[model samples]
Target chain A: MSIAEKLNTYTTGPDEQGHFGRFGGRFVAETLMPLILEVERAYTDARRDPAFKRELEHYAAHYVGRPSPLYFAERLSEALGGAKVYFKRDELNHTGSHKINNCLGQILLAKRMGKTRIIAETGAGQHGVAVATVCARFDLPCVVYMGETDIERQQPNVFRMRLLGAEVKPVTSGTGTLKDAMNEALRDWVANVEDTFYIIGTVAGPHPYPMMVRDFQSVIGQETRTQMLEAEGRLPDSLVACIGGGSNAMGLFYPFLDEPEVRIVGVEAAGKGVETGEHAASLNGGRPGVLHGNRTYLLQTDDGQIVDAYSISAGLDYPGIGPEHSWLKEAGRVEYVSATDAEALEGFKLCTRTEGIIPALEPAHALAHVAKLAPTLPKDHLLVMNLCGRGDKDVFAVAKRLGADIE
Target chain B: MSDAAVATHLAQTRLEKRFADLKAAGRAGLVTYLTAGDPDAATSLEILQGLPAAGADVIEIGMPFSDPMADGPAIQAASLRALNAGMTLAKTLDLVAAFRQADREAPVVLMGYYNPIYSMGVEAFLARAVEVGVDGLIVVDLPPEEDRELCAPARAAGLHWIRLATPTTDDARLPRVLAEVSGFLYYVSVMGITGTKSATREHVAEAVARLRRHTDTPIAVGFGIKTAEAVREVGAVADAAVVGSALVERVRANLDEAGKARPGLADDVLGFVRELAGGLTA
Candidate 1:
């Protein structure tokens, strides 16, 4: 059966309550329930409104520089010596990442809802930069919660966000990373629900957020479908994208979910290695548990305390993946894999040298997997990987890692 | 009745009697909350044991989770302090068990996120909680929609499964929330996290009046009842004025620079609790 045909038989969850097969729900304090419901209602209406769609499309085309190009990685593919690899150049988008796609949609929704304040959480700071850019464009006050540790490492993006008029609040709790940043953001949203719109940077969080974010980001897949047809004359044999909170991967994978012939692979950051007990491969290393308003695969201890996830790429340093990805993995619809920091670094260098694209470490993890899988596949096999972000923000960190002195 | 059912009935009765006594006294009851093992387990235990005598009618023990999104900076810091001091779910229940040994009548509710309880396994946690003499639970993340996951089993295990209702819980949704709820309903007075802003007395009165129409369960208003003045105002309308962040803030303030319990830290926290409880009758 075709992927579309098979999807038709399966339930397209989250049921009425935002659950992707008991994975996603409004697992929040009662104080935030009404606000979440309000967001859900506004988004549901906005989805049907042509004006909203038009506004989003206008911004996507003019502001975000979409639809991003689909380019054949001739050198990289030849180097791999198997599959013909293509690059979905989302890294070229405004704010240098795919994060702006969802931010633009959500910022528009926030305006429609009359929200005066925009808040977000960032790890690698791409989402923080995207949110800050949108807020500046709309003249809304933006506050970004980032971990203290991340703020120091992703300093370039931190300066970028502040330059865009965002107050970058450093979170100091619980290993001071993406999960803590998210917790702080959720806390802020609960406290300032009166005039705030929390632009969650990924396809995680409670109801409406996962569904709404997926819808907004599905633009990636939608564009890729058409662009791939224009380039390859048919669907690519496989799809690959990196998973943090799984937004970029979800954005790229949503439209192709039912395409049974098109294989989908999600790459997670393995840090040193999954077996080393320091990785962000939630699907590979973690189990199903509830955190940050959704039940998904989380890196948690036996006693249910969340374990700190490590990744050289700050974006992939989250403890949990999006609930849809969890469901997808459980149903065996999407294959999940992992790439270590060293492997991802190799992928980053390979893409830079071969394709002349300095990809962000997040998608470098995907490239690492692509590098491995492409070699094993036949030369006739087609593979498209989402180069989700650029590496300009990661230069300093990468330089430090490579023992290169850059003044 | 089954042993579990009987235990649940007793717990329900205990909670009801406290509220009834407050009603007869022409004032509200005080529900004081603090994170277990804050600063240190011994200091936290001392504070827990002292709450009732300090004028607390019931106690809500925060089971510190690594991620507490429902809380503001104060409670979040408290959880961090507890966790940093090596506090665990098992230790939290142990503290409660110690408290229960001396004072068995005060309704103690384990309040926090669900992962800890879930990690311990639902049945196992419930059995442990029951064995430890925990009277009720207020799992913030578990909603009425997810009653089957923990609420149903918690109730079946003979514990009062308290649910939180907020200003956003409209008349339409209140029924579902109140359906399986056994103990008093915790009404979050403000539309924010703990320790942010207090709801006006008029708003609390209106909310309490609305909640009264739906269920006869005692309503305890919390999530911003910080000051004695705010406590007094909330107490006038609701059956209980739940003070969490304000009391936890006391625990935070009374600590030394190194976050160790200073001399009379427990007394200092209990003294503040007394002042907040005094607002109930004032």
Candidate 2:
């Protein structure tokens, strides 16, 4: 069945309490229940009210800069010599990545809900920067939790978040990475559930988060559908994007889940490889376990301890994918695949050389697949990929990996 | 599943209930560990339902704190997830409110560091616990030297203030673990963080027997009680077995794969709990 059909519409049943199939339900504590229901009610009301939609549309277009262009990569396509490639320029969004799209929308919703504080967690600090940017704009007290490890690795974005007036707290527990940051963020939210709004970076969390994030980010797919129709006069043959918590991929894929003609592929980070305990390809290598709120695919040991995950790209280094991705993979509506670090490096260099676009290492994983599949597919076939972020935040890491030293 | 059988099943006020129930049903209660609110309010609820029919029985809902000294990486990750999910000490009570609506039988214990409760003030939290029908609370860092703030109030409220006795606790301190502890004595089998491994009954049996001398409260072992075999071993001595990080780790590991919530998986895990419970009786 299509993704839309699989998702609970909540028209006549379950109220607006948030239900996705039988798996998704609002089993929240009583303190936040009223607030969550309020948010759901507001979202529902806003969704139906034309004025609210128009206001959101206006901000998305003018403030956050929505309708992010879909640029066809002629050079890369020609280099590939077979498949046509198009890049959804989310990398060009306000905060330099697609993370801003969801952040801005959530910040706006926080404002509507009368939330005075904004809490967020970041892996590579992209989401932190995005949340900080919007919270600063909205004048909300923003607190961003980043793993101590990520803060050091992604220093530029960490500084950006602080500069944007968000308090960046470094989490020291666990692997001191995204997962730890997420844990700290949760602790903060629980502590201050009264007036705080949590801006989740990915589509991985529970019910309303995955659904709400997908809705906000779905603008990517919605706009892509319109833009693609205008540009190519038809839908693309295939769509692919990197899946960290899968928000970007879901945003781009939600619009085309019913178009059986348009195949969807969610690429996971293979790290060094799926083996050697160095990968984040949960669907390919992980077992089902509970981590970060939901029971989803995770990289863990036989005893159920969450193993540390590694990837050249910090953004895609999470041990679990979003539960919806799990559901989709099980349903076979979309195919889950992986791209290795070596392949991603090649794709990173290829994008730089062929298209002069220094894509983030996360999307370079998707680019790696393009390099592998383009030559094999028919020349007339088209592939649309979400260029989720720019490479600026990753320059140091990339430089170290590629042995390129700058004077 | 007869009431007679359930009634005939010993009244398990202490840790012994887990084993008693497990033996009666021939299935282990699925134990899921979560922080009160990690990401936000919505996700915490989603996680509660995701288990149960899948395998969980006892849900160890964590109360998020600024300092959780007892937890290791994965559980710390989970605690953060629950905290991020928008959990609070007050919200922890709120979680129990929702929990009571759908599930009344499965014992829900609030586990976390003592800071949040201390911050919340003992009396208010104990009252809230009674109001919310919380079965027990595990304040990991609540040393016996200074637990009157929580223990005294919790007992007055008719709630279980479960205490932990690590391998470090000796014959001198072992009796203290049972003296003040109501609900169940969470015997930390190993000397480490909440998610570490090393479930040896040989070391634990001494502690269990030591506690058995003082109070009749159920002696449930935790910390490293992870595997089914380990559960059986711990159950052989302790009145009830507390398997947390392992069960949570199992739930975490099974996510996203096909047939994760199937009856077979539930049966496999439940059967393991039952076997351990049976071992407790055997």
Candidate 3:
């Protein structure tokens, strides 16, 4: 490769061993290795086939309500009084978030691999709802493992999953959150490896998964790049997105990684605050370690015991981030920051009041960062923030937090 | 059997010697697994010291971590109990060192996830493990694909790199699973976590037979065997019977309401170990 090509980090990555430098690799039990390899092989073949692309495009346009509008947030930019802001508007997607983008792609791969059963782990229930939607479309049996705590808070999505003929199992293990849910899902996959395809709802799992999920979700950036150019005749000066296991953020950041001029910022959820040591900000407070398959930044003890992360946003309430995000954070390709629960609430309210868009609490963290960073930038600076999810599912929790009277 | 090559490289390990002694005695072996500091450190140490006399031909000391993902509820709880009682990787090694001082012949293996050892640095951890009289290492997370990380270095340090081949390990993947594998080949009897489900004798026998085609290392069948009957069933086919969750579950059952070890807990656990060992003799 030429020096210029070598300078571009995007040309190739996460080499055959599934490592993005040292962050991403297939550090799974032997029981799951063969299955993971099968998934990788099927996905590789599907990527090379034209029919797979056609099928995904067909579903994206007609079923998932693709190309979710890139709305120029005039009032939000006015309120910030600095950069011209644009919202990616992924909240308008059929499943009400950016999750379906990858869910749709994986369900198609599962079908190609002759996998008849679908199992997924979900935290905020958006991924569960999306997985259920795809399973319903493809006529496959779906089981979603959700923490009992998440089931209590995300009752509506649980009901939605059941209505779509998917069984929702409550994981009652340690802390009863995303981390526990992932453990339970992995257990199920190992026990039922014959026909089951575990659609890990993030870019965090062992190899092929981080890269495959990133590829599946890259449409977010691909579309954003086209729309930004169509709208402004140039790429946005900066891009921002919230991260849990970092699928949405990876999707938005992948296309721009080679564009040296486009600054990328990832918002991590600082539950109370990073200083308080109660945050879900792995890149901010945690160190590099292995969990849920890949080696990434994790909240762990000196003895390597995983500690539960605290966050008001169940979606971002994870103990670790995606391996690629870990790589990017270390590679200096992405600036990682955090937003407190109180600041996320403020961002939620600002988006609702100013732009008349209610974002899921997960993406509110990104907006919280934007509310801080946008005001400091010059007015001519173009900035894009992924509005990853709709707040319809979060109204009950938000109302309770706001101390509002409910009938 | 496919043990010719691996036996030559790993024959010097304490584990190889223990299995060889068992073979000379014309009996299948009982490999017992106990957490390093379950309930507390005192009773744990006693159980560790008494296992060989109680009929255990090999001992696997679980190095407890925060999340034992590949383990079932029984072993998972065992890990948490050990961690809650202040068990660290260093402390686990200390427990092994203490056990090794008294019993020089019992093969001692340290089993758990990789993060703790990784946190301690692989080279440093490998040196410490060898120094602590650790014979083998069973890291559930490290497959052969990740050999450069720990397997190669550990093997070079004369510590056996024990590999686990599960029901999912097909013929194509078995060779890779056996590569650089020393000590013994642990065949996880079921396709699930430790202690949750048991495989049929037919399944265990068939798996062991298939694995015998790949490597000559002694094959220990684990995952579901609990009682003497289960142990005898496994001993009938495999070279050794590994009972973990059952032993840890016994520890849990003997604990007081406050999760402390009851009086006579060590003797009670040893009695159970003798009962399990009786199956191998039969």
Candidate 4:
């Protein structure tokens, strides 16, 4: 049988009970089970309604600036002297990141459900700014829970969220990072279940969220497929994206899963190095465990205590990855790799100088791997990477790290 | 039967006897909860040993976890304090064993998240807990759907597997909650975490009445029954009133500026438990 035939025969899952090969399930509190089930029901109905699709499409084109360009990196491709490289420019979206896609979908669902309040948790604050922007557009009250440490480091995005009318609640527990912020948001949702809707930032959380966020963000791959076929008259040889809960990667990978010719690669943040025990590469340095409502690969101690994860980029400093990524890793459909902070910094600078595109540190991890692979492949090999966010919000931290004087 | 089986049977009998005694007294039971090693191990043990004498019919000893998502700031801080003082699951079991040596009549229940127990390996933790006389468990993160993970094994070991039901638990979902529930059903009075808003007396009475129709199990109301008046109100309708955060808060208030236990820390905490129990009987 042909490779495409064999791959096409593989069934897509997360069967009726929401188990993506024993990874994703509803492991939340009993109080949250009902609310989560309600969300699943609403999403199921919204997915089937044509009007909901049309309304989502309307906002995608006008509000979020959809069909983000598929730009060929001519200078970087020439410098690599091997593969031709292209970028799926999702960073050009209105909120300056790919986060606005999922936020728009969820806030629309919240409006449909008649929920009056919205709550979210953010690490780098991109998702916070996106959700806050949507809430402002819809005129809903918004509250964002951010770790105190993250609030200090990502001050520009924090200011953006407040300017867009979001109340940022600082969580000061358990290393004060992404995980603690999520815990606080869950606690808040449990308390105010009547009027509030939780807008999860990634392809994590319980049932329907992993599926819903991926479905919303899959516009990236859909556009890329059309644009690639239009530009090269054929599919790309490989695809690359960074994983922090794996939403952006999932968005770009879901559409091409059955295309056997496409090689999918997920890059993880190795803060210092994987051997240093300080990185956030769950697939590389962690084991399967239950946390934050799903079973996934987590950076935890032998005693099941969650360990603090480190990354120069606040966005990638999470201990757990999306459960679907765990399933994909086990199935061997996607190759999971890690890039250290130093390598990411190199990628950041190379992209800025060669392509004239200042990429966020999260996607710089992906670019780092692309830099490594592009030099090894043949000249005609085509590669596509998701530039998931812009770098304007990261200037201060990048400057401080590089010891550059912005003034 | 093996000696393990015999030990399990005795633990079950002790829990059954405590509930029966409460029924015989015609007054609601006072279930006092405190972190096992908050501040330090010695002060926690002193407080645990003094609970029964201070009128606590049943005690819930919190197994400190790094992440307690269902808890509010007060219990979260309590867990942090215990963890900072070098407490582990092994040390928590040791604390229970020490308390059992001093008091044999009062039933002790270990309450917390499930990861620590999972980390210890379920069978070994159950055996050790039964040996140390832990009569029941309330793993807040494990629900009825995942009962096969710990609840079934815990019940098979003859330990009472207590479950929690909230206001969100409707008629359709109540049976799943009551299906594997062994000892008593913990009815979370408020929809929030521990140490938050209080539930009204009318709501508690109504919820208990609804739960009684489903099972013969006793219902214990917890979460936000803080003051003596609130305990009295909850005790009027439920079989027991479980006070956790209020007792933990008392411990926090009595600590020195540096967070060390004051000279009369245990006495003061037990004194507050006594007042809550007094309210139950009033």
DockQ (CA atoms), all models: 0.69, 0.04, 0.77, 0.60
For residues B1-282, write the lDDT of model 1, one tens digit per residue: 123444476534566667766766778889999999998999999999899899999899999989998888899889989988999998898998899899878888899999998888899899999999888899999888678889988888889899999887888788988998876899988777888887888899999999998887888999888888888888888888899998889888888888889999999999998888777774
Deviation in Å, model 2, residue A85 alpha carbon: 0.8
For candidate 2, write residues A1-407 as lDDT tens digits.
66455554322222233333333344222223334556677767766778767777887888778889999999999999988899999999888899888887788778887889999999988888999998888889999988898888998998898899999998888668888787667656544556888898997664467777888889999889999899989999999999888889989998887787888999999998987778989889986654554446777654344667788999998877776677677667788999999999999999999988999999999999878878888988989999999999998998988788962
Q: Tens digits of per-residue lDDT for model 3 on A278-331?
A: 989999999989888889999988878898998999999999999889888877
B29-137 in candidate 4: lDDT tens per residue?
A: 9998899799899999999988998999899999998888999889999998998898888889999999988788888899988877877789999999999999999
**Interface RMSDs of all predictions?**
1.4, 15.2, 0.9, 1.3
Order of quality (TM-score)? 3, 4, 1, 2
Report the alpha-carbon TM-score of model 3 versus the true structure. Answer: 0.97
TM-score of chain A of 1: 0.97
User: How well is each residue in B9-57 modelled by candidate 3, as lDDT tens digits?
Assistant: 5545568777777776778899999988997888899999999899999
Off by over 4 Å in 2: A1-38, B1-282
> Could you tell which candidate, 1 or 2, scores higher by lDDT?
1
**Which 10-residue window in model 2 chain A sums to the lowest lDDT?**
A9-18
- Give one digit per residue, the lDDT tens place, for model 1 in A1-407: 53433455333777888988758887888768778889999998999999999999999999999999989999999999999999889999999999999999999999999999999999999999999999999999999999999999999999999999999999997789999999999988877888999999999998989988888888888989998898878998999999989998998898888777889999999999999999999999999999998889999987688999999999999999999999888777899999999999999999999988899999999999999999999988989999999999988889999999995
Candidate 2 CAPRI-style tier = incorrect
| Candidate number of the best TM-score | 3
The fnat of each candidate, in order, is: 0.81, 0.02, 0.66, 0.58
Badly placed stretches (over 4 Å) of model 4 are A1-11, B1-12
Which candidate wins on lDDT?
3
Model 4, span A1-407: residue lDDT tens: 53333344323767666678778777778888788889999999999999999999999999999989999999999988888999999999999999999999999999899999999999999999999999999999999999999999999999999999999999998779999999999999999988999999999988888889989999998899999999999999999999999999999998888787899999999999999998999999998887888778989887677888899989999999999899888877889999999999999999999989999999999999999999999988889999999999898999999999884
Whichever of 3 and 4 has more TM-score, that candidate is: 3
TM-scores of the candidates are 0.94, 0.63, 0.97, 0.95
lDDT of 4 at B169: 93
